[model samples]
Target: MDRTVVSVLFCFVSYVFQLASTEKNVYNFNGGWETDESKMLARPGICNIDVVDVSKQTFSQKHFEDYYAYVKPVIIKGSTDNTKFRKLCEKTALLERYGDKIVRLSSANTHSYSKRDVELKKYVNEIMKPQTLDTLGNETYYWFGDNDYVEFADLFDQYKAPPYKLPNMHGVYSFGLAAAGTGVPFHFHGPGFGEVIFGRKRWFLYPPEKQPSFNPNKTTLHWLMEEYDNLHQLDKPLECTINEGEIIYFPDRWWHGTLNIDTSVFISTFLG
Candidate 1:
């Protein structure tokens, strides 16, 4: 090869490597890269519910207040047209394109067992039915893995931040096929704001105060199972069956769990 051609090729390779490095940083650090001045500003008022179209308005403090009040953990009838959202949810272009890059959960470790332990495992098994425990355990539960930017870029571009804000709001959303006889273990979000659950399962909500000993930070996988055993001792926990077209907003810092009595697909969006 000519000396000049060799030098040019080396320079081109170096530039390509630098570009790849920068792209990696941008995707991995998305949650920390952007901070908004509005998030830090304080607004005072107990959260309440106002019947407003979420699709039309940007979620503000007033909306948050209303959401905290009547709608939090309560079903919002006609909140979203199921037909429209269903199309978005069913689009498999992104998943098909980036499936190999996505990460799966490690299922090797089995935590301590409780009375409810069998139910929790059974639920997970049902979702990934026909697949062995090892395969399901290794599957990823989160839609946005380390490279979430690639996974959800198109969806974010179309919908924007009104529903799913990135970085600051954690942009945590998940979709799973329904599993009969399975339920999520009781748990609470730490810096929890609210969650919108859409599915065909029966969801149960419990106030944080009711589960006095439940630790949001330290509650292990096994602890959630144990919590279910104590459910009979407490007053009937608020129970609601979540269905398509209905969005349930459960406020932050509340202890909640779900039991999927029938097979269904569910999506949960967390908002701060």
Candidate 2:
């Protein structure tokens, strides 16, 4: 083979490789998923939780213990735009890397929560399609639950856990991918921290004092989705919108619910 020909072939291969790499990271909003704005729920016209910028303000341990550790809810604004989790969550990245992987799709009704197996690609494609106000959480909402999401570890590792995690609080951390208006009903759970990696999420929080009002008769995830409106009858609740790079910490025993206002990806860690 001629030296010149060999060099030309090498250069061509490099160019092709570079193009493929760039294509993988691209998120084409215009051509892909389109969130239905009208279907999105309006934010509660109330304020309760303290929103703070952790980057510019000092977030001390005492502050955590006093207000957030296991007592109240708080939102910490931090940059997640360049985090590994955000990179891997790109539509192209997920489709190219883990589309074929099989996972559980969790959907709930007034009776109980149920799960069905599906290819990740199929689930993503379905959620990306247009959503309706009626089907948002009742019929179309889905959750990606995995005890070992090794495929996304590359991105998850980028955000290290704080030095002061609750003792013995180790369990599966779930990643949620949903369309606008998709949400869960009012419910209370253990302490946990959730962050928005891609889009906006509205959180409706009710302190322990208001728990009785939101606790439905069925007491199941499906029931909550069906009867979530009952919560509106209650007085003002602590509400906040968590955007890309922002995280919300919920204390134990606090009743809360969430609604995605756009095509979104979220990561959450629960403390047992």
lDDT of each: 0.42, 0.65
Write down the worst ten-residue block by lDDT for model 2: 215-224
The alpha-carbon lDDT assigned to residue 78 of candidate 2 equals: 55
Best candidate (score: lDDT): 2
Clashing pairs in 2: 109-222, 110-222, 110-223
**TM of each candidate vs. truth:** 0.47, 0.73
Off by over 4 Å in 2: 1-47, 79-82, 109-111, 127-131, 136-138, 162-164, 212-234
Error of 1 at 8 (Å): 85
The alpha-carbon deviation from the true structure for residue 16 of candidate 1, after best TM-score superposition, in angstroms, is: 65
Specify the highest-TM-score model's number.
2
For candidate 2, the C-alpha RMSD (Å) to the true structure equals 10.8
